[model samples]
Target: MIPEPIPEPRDAESEAQPLDAYSQAVSAVARELTPRVASLRVRQRGREGSGSAVTFTADGFLLTNAHVVGGARGGQAAFADGTTTSFNVVGTDPLSDLAVVRADGDTPGPVTLGDSDGLVVGQLVVAVGNPLGLAGSVTAGVVSALGRSLPTRSGNAVRVIEDVIQTDAALNPGNSGGALADSRGHVVGINTAVAGIGLGLAVPINSTSRRIIGALMRDGRVRRAFLGLVANPVPVPAALRERLGQRDALRVADVVPASPAARAGLRRGDLVLTAGGVPVSQAQSLQRLMFAEAIGRPLQITVLRNGAMVDVIAEPTELDAEHA
Candidate 1:
């Protein structure tokens, strides 16, 4: 066989400019997701506010930030293609900063939701939303961190949103309630808050958030089980970890008087290792287990105390509005 001829390399002048890997990924996602984002015009208490929303269902349900709709009964959702229609608030969960709105007329079509739990730090992400009243704006960045906790207050009840997605994507006030998409164009998070320059947070679209969204759509509200306890993450000792198969645990910092934990004889300095027979390493895990369905139910919580394990039964109560 004849020897293969060497191919000549093309000159720089003759070669076409190529986009980088990140640019290509973002461009592809933006093209598929921009059309699904909606610019919200909310009028509440004689004041008009603007933000972004994403259609979460085919029958005209939209997901947005509760702060964006602030006391607004109805609003207009303007799509990128100029389709504007009136939408009424179905429910609002201020503790999670999520709200559901239903369009009076046509729907913008729902977006493909991704598993935020699968996201890793340094993963590429694209944000699509209406920022500062600009429709269909797109921004790209990498996930800066994970497992962030955001504090939210609804009336006198203060709660923490766990597993919040933190990114470096440039976000403005109007970007709240927008879609944070993965490389495959699936929405992994709902943009929620901006901390500082180059820092943004989104509510992860995990099982917990999905439950809240479903409750909002069906019951017009999310009713959660209240467990009056404040805890912080602490490392479990090697001996205790081997016994419980848990490396870290939540240390009880406070127990409200007459609360479920208090009534169950849980005290401060106790390290919580399991709830409802499942291992729990974060406060959010306990919160997730305390859904509305669990109200008035006996929950078995195992704790590590003084190098020993003890089990207690807590009767969770319905979370009232002022304390949810």
Candidate 2:
């Protein structure tokens, strides 16, 4: 219960403290979410604009899906209180399906990012944003799944591994880049995209965003690490499973020449049966491994090439920074 307002405390020192506890609770939660409940507006050439939900950044930045706000010919943003303002694209990461947008003049307060790594399946979570242009909307759900692989708009698939929290929380189209929070309302993920039945995907902003956002704020771009190779993971069909004696493997689709994979002697058509002793079933299993690994550290890779198993180690390198 909120502490009753004892008619102005007699002590002058005590009078300095505000005593509306109930109001404090409501306002605190609102203050935590209001800045992140951003609106994304885009204008393409002469075409009349469009908008979506976004999140405000810690340092006057706005975050959203790259596709929604990155390539806009003209764009703007709206925060709480109907404050509308112009914006510019700082940088875009199509691979991760994330982008950093910036507004000039002044920006509202930012949201505190929560740890996505600690997100537990079935734990309480909240999706706070303006859905379908409705301002200040909050939807609640429990974490659904942890490791998941989501397809990307750039045709390169995105695999969220290790605490890639899933929730039945309804995330509509406009909810992209809005805050996905824990019960305490700390942001755990950015509402990026939605897919089949209760399965919405988001990019974990914990460590990745820490790096990207810093770079974007300073230079309008992020220097990201990339390993130029493609692995096609095919699940063993239920009927065919018995013959293989194992669940799955990554069938190497393509390898970019001079890439870490190529430089390390990894070949196309190799089946990645294991990664660091973890049995690989799908492409995401490997992608997840990559994301979890240190940027410059060599990874122990196990593959089946022409029915023979091979082991090799390769380090991940940075992706193009300016092109974003």
In candidate 1, stretches whose alpha carbon ends up further than 4 angstroms from where it belongs are: 1-16, 228-235, 251-270, 282-284, 304-313
What is the C-alpha lDDT profile of model 1 across 261-322, one tens digit per residue? 89999999999899998987865687688787899999999998887789999999887765
How badly does each model clash, as a count of residue pairs?
Answer: 0, 4
Q: What are the lDDT scores of the predictions, listed in order?
A: 0.84, 0.64
* TM-score of model number 1: 0.83
Stretch of 10 with least lDDT, candidate 2 = 154-163
- C-alpha lDDT of candidate 2 relative to the true structure: 0.64
Best by lDDT: 1
Question: Which candidate number would show the highest TM-score if scored against the true structure?
Answer: 1
> Residue by residue across 1-324, what tens digits does model 2's lDDT show?
999777854788755678575445444555678665767778676554343545555556777766666567347677777777777788766656567777774667777677776777787677777654577766666778654545332334332222244677787757777777776667778777776677676666566555655666677665555565566555544654586577766667667667777887898888777666777775545555544234687777877777566899888775543212
Give the per-residue Cα lDDT of candidate 2 at 141. 68
What TM-score do all the candidates reach, one by one?
0.83, 0.65
